[model samples]
Target: MSTIASLSRSWSSRVPAKRRDPRCAEPIDVREKRYGYFPKMFVHRGHRYEVYAVERCWTVSRRGRRDRIERHCFRVRCLEGTFELYQDVRHNTWHLQRQVD
Candidate 1:
């Protein structure tokens, strides 16, 4: 590998391929802020995670078998650390997309 590639490989953490088991859609209490739906807290795995802040937000869509799946993605910080959450409109289920390393 090149020098830059080697440096990045050693420095950066890799995204995992295996997904974790999906917890049931947690009850996210949101409030309308200046921009949009701001999540305040959510209960998952019997633990209540209070959102310290929403670091970023974005949207994504992809073609599914029946229709397009649109989702709202959020990068949020809580007591633990940063985590990515997705609200899949097609299924009306919120998913914990991934946890930042």
Candidate 2:
């Protein structure tokens, strides 16, 4: 098989590929932790990455009687790789964004 075809086949096989040497990281139960608003899918390079995401939202009260502001946060973890917090976006009273390393 050609390299491209092999790569495609390997990618389509969504099972977690073996790591040459695996290391342990702290286990995170995103569902229990953040209430399930984070994106469950991620893409890396030209392939899809299986990931678990945690999303949190809180409100900041405005002074006196003004309307409160809502803050949205996303925490994403790659099931096979590593990542970091990237950016946040606000739409009206909520936020939406992506995280990467």
- Top candidate on lDDT is 1
1-88 per-residue lDDT for model 2 (tens digits): 9999999888768534332112222122222223344445544444565556443333333333554434343445666544432222
Which parts of model 2 have CA positions greater than 4 angstroms off?
1-36, 53-71, 91-101
Kindly give the stretch of ten consecutive residues in candidate 2 with the minimal lDDT sum.
19-28
TM-scores for all predictions: 0.67, 0.29
All models: lDDT?
A: 0.69, 0.40
In model 2, residue pairs whose N, Cα or C atoms come closer than 3 Å (at least 3 residues apart or on different chains), thus clashing, are: none
Predicted candidate 1, C-alpha RMSD: 5.1
CA lDDT, candidate 1, residue 49: 76
Error of 2 at 16 (Å): 28
lDDT of 2: 0.40
> Which run of 10 residues does model 1 get worst, by summed lDDT?
24-33
lDDT of 1 by residue, 50-99 (tens): 88888999988888798887988889998898878877777666667677
